[model samples]
Each structure stands twice: as structure tokens, then as C-alpha cells.
Target: MTSSSTQHRPPIGIITTLRSSLPFLFFLLLLLYLISTSKLLIYPPHITTKITCQDSNLTTTNNHPKTGYDTELKHIAFCIAASSKLWKSRKEYIKLWWRPGETRGAVWLDNQVKIKKNETLPDIHISQDTSRFPYTNRQGHRSAIRISRIVSEALRLESDDVRWFVMGDDDTVFVVENVVRVLNKYNHNQFYYIGSSSESHFQNIFFSYSMAYGGGGFAISYPLVKELAKMQDRCIKRYPGLYGSDDRMQACMAELNVPLTKEPGFHQNDVYGNLLGLLSGHPVTPLVSLHHFDVIDPIFPGMKRVESIKHLLESTKYDSGSLIQQSICYDMKREWSVLVSWGFAIQIMRGILSPRELEIPSRTFINWYKVLDFTAYAFNTRPVTGHPCQKPFVFYINSTRYDELRGQIIGIYTVHRERHPRCRWKMESPEKIHTVVVLKQEDPDRWLRAPRKDCCRVLPSRKEGIMYLWVGHCGENEVIEV
Candidate 1:
């Protein structure tokens, strides 16, 4: 009976075995697919959500276009020097007097004037008495507060109707258009104060949200001013001194949980060098204001204003044949010559090197190309190759003493494409092959040749190698040996 049983049963049929294993095979495939698709399994981390105010009570209608001047809610007031002496001594005198003849005529003045069609110019009272006060130390703060009060009085019909009060300095070159545009974009009604905030600690006492425009250009909504005026007793009790008036105001608003929207490019510190560029020539057209601190002397204001106006007119005019044209032509020719010279130099270097010596080491080649790519990316322009007269390529030899060949293999080569055709490639093929030269590590002046046929090699496992080969762009036909 044992002998009969011992006769081995025929091996399980292949079809039967496959049928029995099918479910397991399917389960394994399904699991692999899930694993491949599950990014959470590979990388699990928490994401933080950013929060901000979403209350609608803070909305403002100050920025909207006026269908009728009466419909507008905000009014701007300038704290001009009241007395003739104050006006004569003010830094804004220059701007107000600049091109006096041009603006003196009623017709020209009307065209140049920016008053809205139906909107009357809010009465701008000159406060001679206030200007004479010895509040020069807190002059800016005093001026802002006075302007705020004046604005509050100007739109008195509706105590709750007013939404924003913009107070600016006399010398400041204000841009009403940009002020309106920005206020509209940000919806100024949502915040109580909007200005340029600075984080500098010394000035932090001025305001945690120190308006970068200093105390010169800022917008205070009616609600905030009302709240401050109502809580004047508490605010004064909390912050008793005038030393940090701006700071006190900001602190009070913060206590009320009022947010301040910081608007950049709206205010210019009168002395900033890029003032012309920042203001885009028409400071009054797009910017909120220029502090004019640099023009503290009354005469300089007029001079600066004249210069600004002249520059603006020139910028607007078309030059048919002027120095500008000649300069442009000369620049173009010089640049072209430089580029041609560079190309010739690169060609000469390429001709001097043997094919094997021209091949750069992998790391060195990658680094060099990376430099070129970085420059191109930064400038948003093409790489410039070297010219014949200019040495774009530089060599750096290893000087460290730790290794025997420490001073042996290091060198730097720069390829300025603008001057050298050999160094340049088609704009579309920014990553293509280009000429490279090597020099003695110790004596960079001495040129050396590379020994490889190609500067870089395709790694066997790299997808780039396979794809490039498939596209027939790879030089080597054989598969890379791992």
C-alpha cells in the first residue's frame, strides 16, 4: 500500500496552477498601483492656513469714481503755511512758483488743474497762526492732526458719511490718481489707517506701523478718527505724551482691533535719488505724495519744481533727430564690434586646442554651464561670449596644500557669448555644446588641453541619455555601459 501511494502524483498542471494563483497576482498588482499613486504614504506633513480679517463693516466707498462730486465721501486737505512769511519760507514755494507763466493763465491753469469735473476744490485754509507755533519738533504730527480736523470740518454735512481723510504736507508732490486707484484696489473702508509702515526699531516708537512716508502721507478713515476722538480721554490717559503722537494713534487703533493696510510706492521721501523713476515723472499723477524734506529751504522747492516740470515735458516729447539718437546709434555700433571681436577670439582658442583636450571634466563643465545659465536667467537675457580684446575666461588653480594635485587641476573659464561665436549657441538651444579651454592649475596663464572626446558623458541609468539617444541628438550610438 505504501509503494502504491509513494508513486508521485503528477505535478500540478500549469493551467491549474495559474488559475489558482490569479487572485493573488491581481491583489499584488492592485497594491503596487495604490502604493505608486499614494503621495501621502511617501511624504506626510501638515499644512498651515493663513488667516486675515474678513469683516464687512470696514468697507469704504472713498475710492469709487464720483458720479457727482456730492456723492464722494473722502476729502483731502493740505496744511499750507497761512501767513505770507510762512508761505515765502516754505519749501513748497518753488513748486508752486515753477513755470509761473504757464500756470498763471486761467485757461492753461484750468487744463493743468486736477479738480474733478463736478467736484469743488475742498476749501484749503492757510493756518498762519498755527504755522508760527514752536511745534517744529512735532511739526509733522501737528500738521497731520490739523489737516485731519480741517478735513473733518470740510465734509460736515454727514458726520457718518465721510470715510477717508488724507492729510499731506505742503511741500509734498501728491499723486491723486494713484491714491484713488490704490484705495479702490484695497478697499480702504476695511482698514482704519493706510500708509507706508516701517519696522525700524528706533522709529518704532513713532508707530509700530510707522508709515514709511513718515507722518506725511496717510489716510485715516472717518470711523477711526471718530473712535479716536471719542476715546480721546482714554487714549490720552493710556499714552500721555506728544513724543510719539503717531505711535500713540496707531496703538489706540490697534487696541480697537483696527488693521492698517500698508501701501508701498505711494509715498516718496523727498530726498530719495530714484524720485524721478519712482514718481514716473508725473508725481502728481500716480503717487500719493513726496515729503519734500530735502527742499527745506523755500527757494529750492521752486527750483526742483521747475526742473521736474521740464523733465516731464521732455519725457513726453518725441525726438526726431537729437543727441539721444546719435548716442543710441553709437552704442549699437560699439556693441556689435565688441561682439564680433569676442567671436574671433573664441574661434582662435578652439582652433589651438586638440579635440580630445577640448573636452572638459564633467563637474567643471557642469559648473561653467551653470554660471552661464544663472547669468542669463538673472538678466532675462542671453549669455554673452567674450571678445578678442576682453578676456572673458578666467582661471583659478587649487592652492590648498592638503592634496598633492592641490595646485594642479583647478582653473576658471568664462565664455562671453556676445563677442564669441564659438562660445555662443542658438538662443533656443541655451544648453547646447560650446568651446571650453583649460589652463595650468598653478600658472593659469598657461593653457592646457583636455583628454576626453566630450566635455560631459551620459550616465547609463539617466532618462536624459535614453531620450536624447531616441531623438538622435546623442553623439554616441552605443548604450552607455554602467
Candidate 2:
């Protein structure tokens, strides 16, 4: 009964099986090693059809340039986001800044806008449909997803020789030359998200401090825009809960690891009422853009909103670098503190005010959050001087021109109001000075170097009713003093 030798062979000893097949195992391992090293022609794995991963480096440019680079209007592509219905009225604001045959980019509307023939504006383009993009924000419109795509859209439209892609709302007003100046400071070949946050403290807190409010406008370097375009749609898909375009763009910026390169010049104007106080105390930076014209009083006190913006542009043309530049000087003999917001407004206070105190904005404009909530403003704001004696004698620009003969800029600012309360403590009142003649030497290169508030000196004038003031670079040791 040798049942076929019941040969289990003692179930092959653990090490014996390996020892017996050592050569085969070694051969198999060797084959695998060779295959891994590509030394053997192995069978190809099945070619799976899948979505291609984005090549981030495809559009990345050299962050640093070796040669001199100057950014110009031609180098920037502006993508203005607007509601199709609002385009008619808002185009006036855009026309104030957009120079036809010079400026590039388009106005991205949610739908086609009925632009008039020969309208002085950028090309109007209906924005690509964004209905497929999920937007779960309970309070915000889905247009946010559309507006957030503007930079990417503009990038695709004008990729060649474009250094920056500037984005804003149709109501946004840009000092285009100054926009060039600000963009020039950074290497556009690098990843840069340049703009200021919302003027409203609550708006910034609600959205993000790093976001560049779209109403105010923001600039994205060409390289950054290209990279953003690569993933913007996907990025928007991920951020379905964002409240606005700026926040969504900011979210994508976060993904790209780029922080907001804040240029305080961009004004979100997240406030209401007169903008006089805000513009008067502007920071000593180029005034690149102004937004929220639809919500606030005209920048200049006495003119229509569009006309006022154009008047400001009139001054900007002669000296965009110095426009809204706050140059504080004093008529010490008269005991008056004169603040010449060059190309903007003039504020004459009855008493000597230290520059430190006057630099903070006066709360003339209504805060977006709450008029009474002093904490609602993003920056410091002193309450409007209810005391007539301490209040400023306001003046707005009447006209501006490049005095070709003098090779400088001449700005005329007249009293915004007819009369004011009599100041008891005044050495000599500004009331007699019917007009302020501001003469500024054209220093196109002013912002090219370091930035400081230009100095204003009250110059003698033979005319009885007019006061003459000169604004320019202060002397080596000059300081704004009382």
C-alpha cells in the first residue's frame, strides 16, 4: 500500500525551497532590476487616458531681469469687469483713464454690452459663461467667479509683450501713468499681486486682509497671470464659497504662495459721501487708482462725478506722479497750516497743525460699515472738526494745465464753499485768498527714486485775491514744519 509513496516530501522545508530555487529567484530579481533600470525591453503597461496634469513651469518667466526694464501703458493689459447693464454709465469712468490706440485689454462684461460707435474705451468683451462653476456663497452673486477669471482671460488675450494684467471694475478710475509707475517698481516677470485692501475695516476682516479690492483695482504680473490662468478655473471650483472676486483671486494667490504686494496708492474707497477728506490725506505714494465713484460724492466737491474725475485726470496728465501728493507747509507768519494735496485739493487750517496730526484722514466720507463706528475704517481717521475754528478751509481744483512756457504744471484751486465761520485766533485768514495757484515743476522722475511728500512753499504774489504756492522737491534739510 505504498500509496504513490504518499510523497509530500515532508512539505518541503522552509529554507530548502528557497535554497533549491535560489538561481530562479535571483534571475527573477535581476530581470526586475534590469526592467526598472530600462536595460530590458519589457512589455508596456496599458496607456491610461486621464486628464493631463498642468505644467506650471510652462509659463513661468525669469523672476529677475538682467537688463533695464521700463513698464509702459502698452505693457499693461487692463481687464475691467462690469455688469452688462451698468456698462453704459460706468464707461464714462473708464473713458477718463483708458487711452484709445494706446492702452490694451478689454472690459469683461457678464453679457454683451451695447457699446456706442467710436466710444473711447477698451474693447468690450462678453465674459465667458461661468454657470458651471459652483458658487455656494449664500450672500454673494456668482459674478464673483466671472470677475475672478478676468486676469486669466486678459492674459490669454494679450500674452505677448505684456508685463502686467491690471484688473478693476468699470466704475474704477485709474491714474494709468501712475499705474505704470507702480508696476515698474516690481519685476513683472516675477509673481507679484499688487494692490491695497478695502478701505472698510470690516470689509477687510470679512474677506481677507491680503486681498486687493477689485473696485479699487489690482495688478498681476504677466508671469503670475499666466500661472494663475493655468489653474484659475479649478481654483474657482475649489473656492465656491468666496464672497467676491477679490477674495477668490486672493485665494488663488494664496495657492500660488504670493502675498499681496500692497501699494497703498490703490484706493478701494469702501466708504460713502465726500471723498475730499480721504483724498486730501492720501499717503505719500502715487495715487494709482480710485474706486467706488458710484457710491461716494464726486472727488472734487462742486463738480459732477464724471467731470470731477476728468478734472483730476487733467491734473494727472501734467503730473500723475505728484497727483494727490500731500505736500505740507505752513504760513508760519500767518499761523496757518496749509496742506497742498498737489493736483487735488488744498486745506488751510486756522491754527498751526503738526504734520503728524494732519496726515491722518478726516472722516468726511461716510464709513461703509457704520458712520459712528470709528473702528470701521481701515486707517486712522480723526472725526470731522465740528469746531469751525479748527476745521479746514476747503478748496478744490478748478483747472490744471502744463504751462508749456514755464515747463511746469499750473493748478488752480478755488474755494469749495462761498464762506466759512470767522476764526477768532487767526493771524490772517485764508478767506481773502480767493484762489490758490499751485505751481509745480514737472518732475516726471520724482517717483523713480525714493518717495517723500513734496514740500510746498507759499510764494509772494502781487495779486491781492490770489495766493501762489510752489510744490517740488524740498531742500536737502527741509522738513514739513509748523
lDDT of 2 by residue, 1-482 (tens): 35564654455586688799999999999999877544111111221121121323221123423323677889998988989878778888888888889999988888876667887888878788889999998999998888898788777679788898889899998888888888888888789999998888988888889888888889998888889989888888998988989999999999989999999999888898988788888987888898888888877766799998888888766777888888888887778889888877898888888888888888888788656787898899888987768778878888887655546666888887756766676367777776887777676776655566777887655566577777776766666754
Off by over 4 Å in 1: 1-85, 89-161, 198-207, 210-215, 268-286, 293-303, 306-482
Residue-level lDDT of model 1, residues 132-204, one tens digit each, is: 3223344345443333233333334335445565644444444443444445444434555777643122233
Residue 414 accuracy (lDDT) in model 1: 29
In candidate 2, stretches whose alpha carbon ends up further than 4 angstroms from where it belongs are 1-68
Clashing pairs in 2: none
Question: What's every prediction's RMSD, in angstroms?
Answer: 25.5, 31.1
Clashes of each: 27, 0
lDDT of each: 0.32, 0.80
TM-score of candidate 2 relative to the true fold: 0.83
